[model samples]
Target: MNDSSSGRTRDPSPAAEDPDLVRARAGDDAAFGRLVAPLRRELHVHCYRMLGSVHDADDALQEALLRAWRGVGRHTGRGSLRSWLYAIATRTCLDAATTRRRRALPVDLGPASDRVPPDGVARTEVAWLGPYPDIAITTGPLGPHARYEQREAVELAFVAALQHLPGNQRAALLLFDVLGYSVAEIAAMMDTSTTSVNSALARARRMVAERVPPATQQQTLREIGDDRLRRLVTAFAAAFERRDVDALVALLAEDVTWSMPPLAQWYAGLDAVADFATEVPLGSCPSWRSLPTSANGQPAVAFYLGEDRTGTHHGWSVTVLTLRGDRVAGITSFVGEDHFVRFALPVSVGGETAVGRCS
Candidate 1:
């Protein structure tokens, strides 16, 4: 099998010599499964990038694989199976994108609140951009020429920016830039002219550049190094567990912003965020238990809220921190019990020896 970064054009059916390919084309279901297994993980990532939700990616990938299986005989062995599968997956996501609402974060809904309100209402009408469990994300770029690493491509900023794009532009940008497909190859895969592909790519690049950060979280993390980065994340979770507002504030950058999806209100600037932190997680919430984790290639904390009489701490939010240098620059707390399962975290932390604990 060719590496994902391998260029598009090659000898027809490089895998044609494999018996499995012959069996798959000739209608062996097990053979088809063997052919698809290796490419499945990356394909799922591609779908997630396109749809901006893990649930949506799951649905799209299932449909794409089924379609590929049904059309296996017609594959003609003219291109690599991986590229063929990606084309199916990309189109599947596009079709889903047309009918579904685009995912968003709280910041997208309105201007930042200057101070904390008594409470913020959950906006169920908005489809929030959910976090990806970085454990499942591959570490490197899909291709050598790909601009974004696999983890960087899934960073909150990058995926959130993708949600703003129109379907064609989104597909073009992901295919050409993130997946490193040549314009001519993308044109063929997308069933469009090379000129059309180039135009779409140009437009997509401009819009994405406007929203995604100049420095990705991946680059920042590399500079921080593992030991210091781990300590910074540990300190962050500890502050919340101890309800130490001062410690938490100290970890934040001067212009730090805090946002929680499902909550339409967001806090920006040090004072505004500190005010909200002082009022909410540090105040209104009686107690918090935290477990250090990672998401979107950034350090994160999985919080469990107020314990029951039985001493079970219920799951709360997966808070992902975006670092600028060694300080926390942005905090995105994806608040919902539903998020925990994706990270393989239990819904409640019983009286266990988890990393961060306070009462």
Candidate 2:
């Protein structure tokens, strides 16, 4: 559980000379960069998990670095530099969370067709769910000393579920349980008693567990390769282009669930979801296209539709599909133009299409 195995090691003695640190503390830019470089990616991930949004993580990380640079001269070497940075980052995140409410997807809001606030209203005002970088998954295996255990725990569902907990509770649980910080360490980081940290952790865990459904046994749909995933995307495009509800339904599981966040409504079962699709505005919008992408450790499609006048394509939802065997278990569509760029999806589907605008 030491720092080296955890991927948080500092430079060896001569390389990490006291004089170099002293110079860095006195405002040497190159020396300071060396000190901060090792911790950047891990700190970003930590902030993402704590804030539940990539954008927020970026902000918090910058703030933490600035704070560290400004205060570096006061470094008494009382503790590990990694821990110290984490303490600063954790406080920054807590401050941000305290000012803003938590974010949730449709499932967290409630059942299907529930009366909810308008999109970009109170829901967005409360923290909105955010995207994560795929590189976080491809990183090498974590050691026993790694701060965060179970990287999948930062998946979209898990993060969306986290929005249900109060801010302090979320911070405490992430610091103690996910990050493997000692209870006393968490207390020190949050400036609370050890007993309070324990209580917050218990409450946060219970709340998150209650909100998120247990992971069911299903086919592993994550990173199945580009070719196979493109097939699914192609199938989806053809079905939607033809406005063929039956064809689309064929791709879904019997118990398939569909949801769109911010609106706070969801549909369960094939028939119910089919009815919603066929009856909604989706029925009218034809000439659909989907580009392949990944999110929440699952295969996903970023959708676009052809513009009638310019023949250009416009943005649509990024749908993360859960597969049971070969059938689709769930389809969660994250809609909005902003989400398209944030998730690094294309503005349009790239291919020639014979299908014209459907009447």
Candidate 3:
């Protein structure tokens, strides 16, 4: 089967050979693992786009794999194994969406706040959008008619906009645009008519366009080149460490935005963001040390805050930067020390070092 995102035909899994298939069908765990292993990472990413949380995606993909494994015996081999697996994963995500609320950012809830609130924003009860650890993502259109690259679909802006869409609309859009599924195929997967699928796609496209920026992060990163990208990320991290608000401001676009998830407030524009820097992160928050990392396929810094007299530091937040041309256009800082656990980051730092060993 042709991978929609690439021109070359995808190699059939070694397990798809008759002998291996038979073994898997007969309930050999090792055979089954080989049968599905090739597709697991991509399928997990699909689940993430569908459901919007790493934990949720992990759970949904596991359930989908279980369902696929239990039902492997029924396969007639009329279709590509990849398509069949995707159908199951899509169904799994749809089920989860029906039961749980959509994930979102603070910006989705209300207008941008000029500065941080006195007590800080509430972190409990809200289903805030979580950052994705750096993972391989397919770039370029899935097919001749596709819209978003696999990685672009997961960018903070794109993902946030998607959360506002109704579940079915979101699914149809991802399958058709990101994964390059045909209209009829999507209808069949979603158990709807072709006409209905078309309508969903139309609405989903419009809503996403309305919410997302004109240029994607992927496009911007490519334009900037790798060496420059590294320098840019490092500069931001250095500025944060020094609490140099002006230096930070110098790197921002005229209308840059900064939002801290779980915090209802966000800052927009150079002046407002600078005000925020002076009063909040720079002024109120404790000492910081940041390590360069990537999240959602974009440059990010995981920050550690010094919390005690002994100079101990703990995971503070993961700040993902969004750029436009040569300047930073947006910053979404996902707060909460607990978040470090998800990224395999150290929970707390000490012993004459701190957040990822003093970096």
Q: Top model by lDDT, which number?
A: 1
By TM-score, how accurate is candidate 1? 0.92
Q: Which residues of candidate 2, in runs, are more than 4 Å off?
A: 1-20, 114-126, 136-150, 216-219, 222-234, 308-310, 324-326, 349-359
Which candidate, 2 or 3, would have the higher TM-score against the true structure?
Answer: 3
RMSD of each: 3.9, 5.1, 3.7
Give the Cα RMSD of candidate 1: 3.9
Mark the 10 consecutive residues where model 3 has the least summed lDDT: 1-10
TM-score per model over all chains: 0.92, 0.79, 0.90
Assess candidate 3 and give its lDDT.
0.80
Candidate 1 residue pairs in backbone clash: 5-143
Error of 1 at 216 (Å): 1.1
lDDT of 3 by residue, 29-142 (tens): 788898788788888888888888888999999999999999999876666677788889999999999998889887777888755566674667878888887744444225
Angstrom error at residue 359, model 3: 23
Better of 1 and 2 by TM-score: 1
Ranked candidates (lDDT, high to low): 1, 3, 2
